[model samples]
Target: MSASELPYQYIVLRCVPRPEREEFVNVGVVLYCQASDFLQAGWRVDVERLHALDPRVSTDQVCAALEFIDAVCAGDPRGGAASEQPRGTRFGFLKAPRSTVLQPGPVHGGVTTDPARQLEHLVSTLVG
Candidate 1:
C-alpha cells in the first residue's frame, strides 16, 4: 500500500513518574496511534525532546528511529533503496506503517546495550 494509504501507530516511552523527578524510576512503554498527518514529523521532534530530557539517550538509538521512518517512507522496512517515485509523490500525506518504539537506559550508554536490543525487539514485533 502507499504510504498515505497505510495505517500508522506511535508508541512513546518515558521515564516513570508523570511529573518526571530526578529520582523517577523506569516506566514501561506507552503506545498511541491516530489517523493524522503529523505523526512522523512528531516522531522526529520527539527524538530531540527525548535527548534534551536525558542526555544519556544515544545518537544511535535516535538514528534508529529516524532510519525506521526513512525506511517506511522509501517503502522498505529493511532500510533498502528508495522507491522509483519522486520524493514529493512518495508519501503524499498518507500515514505510513510507522511506529515509534522506546526503551529506557542510561544516557550516553551504548545502543548495543539492553535498551537498544529491546528497541530492536519492538521493531521485529511490529514488522512481523
Candidate 2:
C-alpha cells in the first residue's frame, strides 16, 4: 500500500440470541484507524434476519450495546473512561474478549486511504 494509506482494524458486532447453539447475525461494524485518529461504527437491526433466528429474541440489550459502541466511537463522555483514552485503546476496548448478547467477532485489518469509506463498505457487505 502507499504511504498515504493507513492500516486499520475492524470487528463485526453480532447478536447471538442463541448462544448455546452458536447462532448469530451480523448487527454492526466498528472500524478504527489510529494513524488518522479515526474511529467509527455503523449498524442496523435487520429484523427479518433476527426474527428468523429467534422470533422471541429481545433486542433491547442489543440496541443498547450498539448505541454504546457508537458513543465510544464518537468520543462521547458518556462512553465512560475508555472514551477518554487514545483511539487505539478505545478500539481494543470494544473488541469482545468475552461473549455476550452483543459480541464482537475476530479482528480484521486492511490498508485504506479513507477509513470512512472502508467502514461503509464493510457495513454494507457484512451487516446486510
Candidate 3:
C-alpha cells in the first residue's frame, strides 16, 4: 500500500547523546500508527524490523529514540512534552535526541543509524 493509504501513521525516532561526543551515535526507530496506537500491526512490523536489524538494541532505547524524533518535529528545543499532538499533513510522528547539533555520523556494526535516511533506505529496499 502507498504511504497515504496505510492504515496508520508512521513515526521516526532519532537518538543522540548529550555533550556531543563522537561516541554519541544517533539511532532512529520508525514506529507505525499514532503514538496512542503504537501497539498496532504496523507498529509491530516496525519494531520487528528494528530488532531484526539490530538485536542488541533495547525497547527502552527505541522509546528514547521516539521521544527525540517527536521533539524535532514539534520544533521544541527541549524535546517538547511527552504527549501526542495533531501533526500536520505529513500524518506521521517524529522524535529526536535532546541535543543541539543534529549531524550525520557513521553507523556501527549491526545498528541502523539515522531515521530519515533509514526510512529512505527502507522504501528503496522494498521497492527495488
lDDT (Cα, tens digit) per residue for candidate 3, span 1-128: 43333233333223233334333233433433432333111111244544554555465755554455546444446545533454432232232233432222222212233333444564344322
Locate the minimum summed-lDDT window of 10 residues in model 2.
95-104
Q: Rate the local accuracy (lDDT) of all candidates.
A: 0.36, 0.90, 0.37
- Clashing residue pairs in candidate 2 are none
Residue-level lDDT tens digits of model 2 in 1-128? 89999999999998998899899999999999999999999999988888899999877777888888888888898898878888888999999566677889999999999999999999999998
The TM-score that candidate 3 achieves is 0.28
Per-model TM-score on C-alpha atoms: 0.28, 0.94, 0.28
Candidate 3 overall lDDT versus native: 0.37
Q: Return the lDDT, model 2, position 54.
A: 93
Candidate number with the higher TM-score (1 or 2): 2
Judging by TM-score, tell me the better candidate of 2 and 3: 2
Off by over 4 Å in 1: 1-50, 77-128
Best by TM-score: 2
Better of 1 and 3 by lDDT: 3
Candidate 1, residues 1-128, lDDT tens digits: the string is 44444233334333322233443222222121233322222222333444556657555765564555455444563644433334433433222322333333322211222333344454444322
